[model samples]
Every structure is written in C-alpha cells, then in structure tokens.
Target: MSDHDPRPDASALPWSCEAEQSVLGALLVDNAAYDRAADLLRRQDFFDTRHGDIWDAISRLVLAMKPADVVTVFDALPEAKREEIGGLAYLGQLAACVPSAANLRRYAEIVRERAMQRALMQTADEALEVARGEGSFEEKSDRIGSLFATVRETGQRSKPLFVGDLMAQRVDHYNALAQGTVTPGISTGIPGLDEALGGGMWPGKVIVLAARPGVGKTSLAQQILLHGAEAGHTGLLLSQEMERTELVDRAVANLGSIGYSRLLNGKLSNPEWQRLGPAVDRLAALPFAIDDQAALTLHDIRTKAFAIKGLRLLAIDYVQLCAAPKGAPRNHTRNDVLTEISRGIKALAKDLGLTVLLLSQLNRDVEKRSSPEPTLADLRESGAIEQDADVIAFLWRVREYESHRLIACSLPKNRQAKPGAKLGLDFEGHYQRWRDSAEKVGHTGSVGGSADLGFN
Candidate 1:
C-alpha cells in the first residue's frame, strides 16, 4: 500500500481509529500514559488472538515513528523476511487487519477515546472562554450539556454477544425466579422479618421501611445488619445519625444479647464477662462495615459502595440525610431535597443490584389526632419515595406512646403485597422487641410471652 493509502483490510478494522485517536490524543495531551490504551484494546475478542498482536506492533511503530527507531526495528527483523515484506508493508499490517470485524472494535474504541479527549479539550477551552466572559451561564450550560449529549450518543451501541444465539442458549436464567433460588444471599436480620420479607431481601429490590421517628426504624435496620452478618453476609451499614462506636454498642446490645447499659457501664459478672468477651469477639469478626458520616452525598455513597466486595444488602439508615449529586443544586424547600433523595436511593438500588432498606421518618400530623395511622401521602418531603420504592413498610408499636393497647402495623400503600393487610406485632418495653401477635393469639397465648424487637 502507498503511504497515503490505507491497506485493503483497513475497512474491516474491528475498532475505530477515530475513537482510539480521540482517547489517546486526549490522554497524551494530558500527559497520561498508554497503559489504559492496552486495557481498552484487550477488551475486544479478535484482539485476544490476532489483532491484539498486530495492534501492539502498530503502537510500538507509532511511538517510535522516528527514522532512527524505525531503522532499529527494521534491522531487528530477519533479513530474508525483511527483504520480502519491506518496512512499508510491515507498517501496513495494521491497515491490513483494520477491516477485520475483530480489529474494528479496537479501532472504534481508540477512535472513541480520541474523540472524547478532543471533546474534553474543547470543553476545557470553552470553559476557559466562559471564564473570559465570552458566554453567559445559560450558554455555557447548554453548550456543555449538548457536547456531552453528542459524545454519549455517539458511544458504541453493542458488542457482539458472547453467549451466542438466543435460541441455542441452554442456561436457565430464570431458575431463581422459577425455582426460587436465592443467589444474591441477603438476610433481613430478623428471623421473623426474613420470613415476612419472602426469605430476606432479594437482589436489586428496593425495600422502603417508612416510619415515624422513635418507632424502632433504626433498631429494625440494626436487626437486619445483625441477621445478615449472622448468615455470613458482608453487610455495609451506612448510618447518618449514629457514630461508629454507637453502632457497635447497639449491635452488641441488640444482637449479642448483652445489656446495653452493662456494656456501656462496663458492669458484668465474671461468668457474664466470659460470655460477653467471646460474644464481642464474634461480633467483631462478623463481616460488617459501617460508615456513620453525618451528611454524605449520594455520589459519595455510590463511590464507597463500589469499593465494597461481596456486598449483599445495602441499608441506608435514612434517605433524607443524603445529599444530591454535585449538579441538580438542592432547591430551597425540603420537598425538593426529598425528590432528589428518593431518586438517588432508587438509582443506587438499581445500580448496585442489592436490596436497599431506607429508613424514612413520618410526618407528625399522623400522631396529632386519635387513631394514629400513616398514609402514603404522609411520607415526608417528596412523593418520589412512594413512587420509586418497591415496598413501603411503616413501624407502629401500640405501647410506644400509649398504655397497653393494640396497635396495627398498616400498609396503606404496598406496591407488591396486598394493601390494607396489617401485620400485627406486639411491643414489650422490658426486652425492647417486636413480636408477631397473630400466631400467638391463634395458639391461645400458649407461646408464653409475646416476641419483641429486643431493642434496648
């Protein structure tokens, strides 16, 4: 092939040179190394075999395009083969492999990278121009938004499927849904709660536990962490209110069967101390990690979640505390903030493919009058929580603020479960636990004392 002409197979390039050039040029202009280029190239199928080999040769040649380096590379090749192919055709190998569908992917990827870099550079330039008072805020935002839109829109649509044809596929993907196999493996932290939640939280489900504050929302969340850890699940508990030590104390008191006051006051009998020591050790050993940052943004949480391995269930202590992404500036009203919070939580649930249980505080309006019952409209701040949440649960204990009275845990709004079906639970102050009252009443109260949340 002539110096100006691309080889015959150039059209078959699996990857886009424009993309590679865009990314490489962008990175190079920023003085970034070519290691990522190697990575980008390796993701292609043909690159795994032939194109990868030829691409490396092309990269080496391009980097050392200087005449002296070219001479050295040529000299290294065998004399007879060198004479037969010559330097030009040796360089033409890249062009020859370019048209192959396999190589096309690498070329396209490289071109995309180059385009991105160019666009980014242009963006920086435009930003500089904006800083120089060349454009208004509206103009800059629109321009930046449009440029990103173009680049995002231009990205490769799909790669060839590795799984072959759909008709010939044999793997039973729906076995989990059909045979009821639980793959993600999450425990709801309460044995009874797990049973109620269809054998604990399934992957990629959003479980919104909405309740008025001081009604055992946080305690229930802690219970989930305990149950999950007990079941050998690695739990990441992101709490907004409590500090790490406070969480540890609560976990020990709630799940470890240690008295909260005793643990805090450092009071225990010798035998009790022996039991608590190993219990504390076991609690420490459980695959649990907690972040108690007071006001973390959703982006920050998403970043941290990405770092966690074997992550099963994600429990956000409360959703409202989370800040929105860098953009979408929070509006003046808490309603606006709630809108952002709901969107963030839902996005996180879908993105991470894990069950998310978000603790939500209810409006005090539900408590002002007699017969306190929560409505879906009572969800604080925004309706996005109700709209996006898969399941919404409210916590109501009869004796929390009242004397011995029967309180109903009602689900006025259930996305999946039957609406108006109340899950009856009894509250005990001494043990601080919520127990199922339905089975007990049917059994004629023969089960001794009723079950409680065992909260302190």
Candidate 2:
C-alpha cells in the first residue's frame, strides 16, 4: 500500500510489515503451509493492504487446486492491483527472501496479534469520543460495551467440519456425566424440586419465580442463592426492595432455622441462640454477596456482575422494582419501562452465561382469582419476562389446614422439562424457609395467614 494511506502511522499503531511479508513468502515457497495460515490469519490481519491482496490472490489459487507459485499468483492479480503493489518483480523478491516455510505459523501469529492491538486501540478511541458527548454513566458504559463487543465478535470463515471429531467430543461429555465429573446443572439441594427442574437451575437460563406480595418469594429466591453458594458456586443477590440486613437475616434464618422475628428484633429463644453461631460462621464462609442499593439501574447490576471474579448465579429480588435507566422516553408507561428492563436483563443473562433466578411480583388479579393459583399471565408489569424466561414457576400460599398454609410451587412453564406439575412445600415462617411437604390437596383446616413479607 502507498505510504500516504489514511491509516495511522506504522510506529504509532501495532503492525508488522516484515511479518506480513514473511507470511506471504512462506505460502509461495510451500503451498502446504497455506492450510495452517488460512486457519489463523484473515486478510484484515495484514498491516499493508498490498500484502493482504497478495495473500487473498494466493488463497484463491490454492483453494481452486491450482499451484500458487510467484508466476501464477502474479498473473492472478488485475493490472491496476499489479501496478499498485510494485508489480510481479516485488512478488519474486518476497519469494526469494524466505528460506523455508518453517516459520509460517509464527509469522501468522504476529500478524493476528498486531491486528488485535489495532482493533482494541480503535475501540478505545471510539469510546472516548462517545464519552465526550453528553450521556449518563449507564449510557456511556453500554456504548463502551457495544464497541468492545464488535471487536470481540470474530468473523466466520469456511472450514472443514468432521462428524468423527464431534462424536469424540460427545463421547467424552457422556463419560463425564456418567462419572459425575460434572453435575447436570447448578443443583437446588431440594430433591423433588430439583427433579421437577430436570436437575437444577441451568446455565444460560432465566428462571422466573413469581408470587403475590405476602408469599415469601424473596425468601425462596434467597434460599436458592445460598444453596448455590453452599455448593462452591459464586452468587450475587441484587435486591431493589429488601435492605442488605433483611437479606442476610433471611439467609441466617434459613441456615440456622431460627425465627426470622428473633433475628430481626434481637430476641432469640435459647435453643435458637445455640444454633445461631455455627450458622453465622457457615454463612460467612460461603461465596455469596448482596447488593441492596435503593435505585439500582440495569446498568448498575450488570457492572456489579462483571466485577465479581467468578460469578455463576445472580438473583434479582423482584423485577418490577429496578429503576428505569436514564434517557428513557418521556412518554413511556410503567409497562413500557418494565418491558425494556426485562428485555435488557435477559440479554445480560445470556451475554454473561449467568444462571439467573429472577423474582417477579404477580398481578393484583392473582389475589382476586377464586382458585388462588398463579399463572404466567399473573406476571406483573411486564409480559416480557414470561416470554424471555426459560422457566416460569409460580408460588402461592394455599390454605389446606388451619394450623399452617402450604406454599405451592408450580412449574407451569419450563422449557427444558415437562411443566404443569406442583410441589407442596411447608413454609416454616418461624425460620422464614420452605421444606418439601407431601401434604394431600384435600386436607382441611381453618386456613389463615397474613400476606406479610415481614415474616421473611
């Protein structure tokens, strides 16, 4: 390429003209090296467009099953391109300089490395220019993520696909499953419930747990987060509704089987006091964290997730409560705002390969219905969660006996398993937890319990 080309100065940007030349020469000397070079280097990886052009011409001839020596490659180029790159004589010079094809792959590696550096530099400059314009942190942060995403996405190139190669991988995967080298997914520690979930909360999946105000949805979500943490997986609870103290106390109650009230009011019974210390120590040791920021935007949650070193699971307390990001359209309704947030969160979960346990608030109609059962339609504020989530499990307080209410866990919409099955869990309000119950549906009592989240 001409020296006056608009690209940045060679010294300022990362690129190796000599390495690019060596790569071209290696291919011309030994056609067998072209296969390895094609796998590693794209035309854009060449610093000088002239070198890139020569590589492209050689690639076409090699793929066409024609010999790509200096002569045939020189004749392959158009007249204008030939004049632009110093003519057939320049190709001859390149072929004469390289002694052998021994260093072809190494030269290709240098070309690819320099190309990545240039891409990163371009991304930084674009991000800086966008930041100079007016925007909130959320907007600017999202813009920078998009810019880097462009660089991170690789262009697809045609290559060989062998089924024998794939079958070998599948056999290894099956062996791993059989040998317990990997559990099916993140297990819930609840036997029947885990069975209903087809093993557990899966990676790259969104599970929505929706309920009305008094149903202990937050407590249940907290239970799952702790379960994951106990299994050595890192987790985060990003709650917009609950305070950090309430979350921790709920965790303590679930772990210690202590009354949630006692933990809140510092009035523990004697036996409860005995169980508290070990539970506290265990909870302290688990790889779990909570963010109870009052007005957390979607952007804030994403930043927090990325910052955690090895985050595998995240629980957003109740979807309707997250703040609308700045610069939302002025005329958007609450549904519109929630729809946008739900869409954004689903994208975030997939982008990060997170196993998201998203708590949702059911519509007021859930309380008014005669059967008192929740459904996908009861998902409040946004239909987007129902559409985006991989699983939709509903929770409700069903009064089958006067002594206590049974928390019915219904899997009405599971993408990976058979849905429409229910699990009856005895809600231990004293400890703010749920344990599996096999209570028959017809058992009767003077059913009564307040829909009070304070129990959690």
Top-lDDT structure, candidate number? 2
**Residue 440 displacement in candidate 2 (angstroms):** 4.7
Give, for candidate 1, the lowest lDDT window spanning 10 residues: 440-449
In lDDT terms, how accurate is model 1?
0.57
The estimated TM-scores of all candidates read: 0.62, 0.82
Residue 244 displacement (Å), model 2: 1.4
RMSD of each: 12.7, 4.1
**In candidate 2, how many Å is residue 383 off?**
4.2
Name model 1 segments beyond 4 Å from true. Answer: 1-185, 269-271, 324-331, 400-408, 412-421, 425-456
* Per-prediction tally of clashes: 43, 2
For candidate 1, write residues 1-456 as lDDT tens digits.
223222354443443444433332332222223444544443232222223333444456546652212344355445654544345454344334333233333544555464455556666676676556655664555455545445544443444545567535444644554676643236554444455555557777777787766566776676677777777767788999878997787776655556556677788666557767777888888888899886666555665676788776778888878764334544546677667667766766766677777888888887764555577877887888888887777766454333222334555555544555565565433223445554321111112134443332
Give the TM-score (vs. native) of candidate 1: 0.62
User: In model 1, what lDDT does residue 50 have?
Assistant: 27
Superposition error at 172 for model 2 (Å): 2.8
| Residue-by-residue lDDT tens digits, candidate 2, 1-456 | 224352557668988877888899899999988987888788788878888889999999999999999889988988789878778878888897789999998998899988888989988999999899888877887777667756765532446878887898888888998999987789876777788898788888889988877777887778888989999999999988888987888889889988887788889999999999999999999999999886667667777888888898999987888877666678988888778777777877877788988888888886665677776888887778888889998887666443345877888899878998788877777677766787743322224555554544
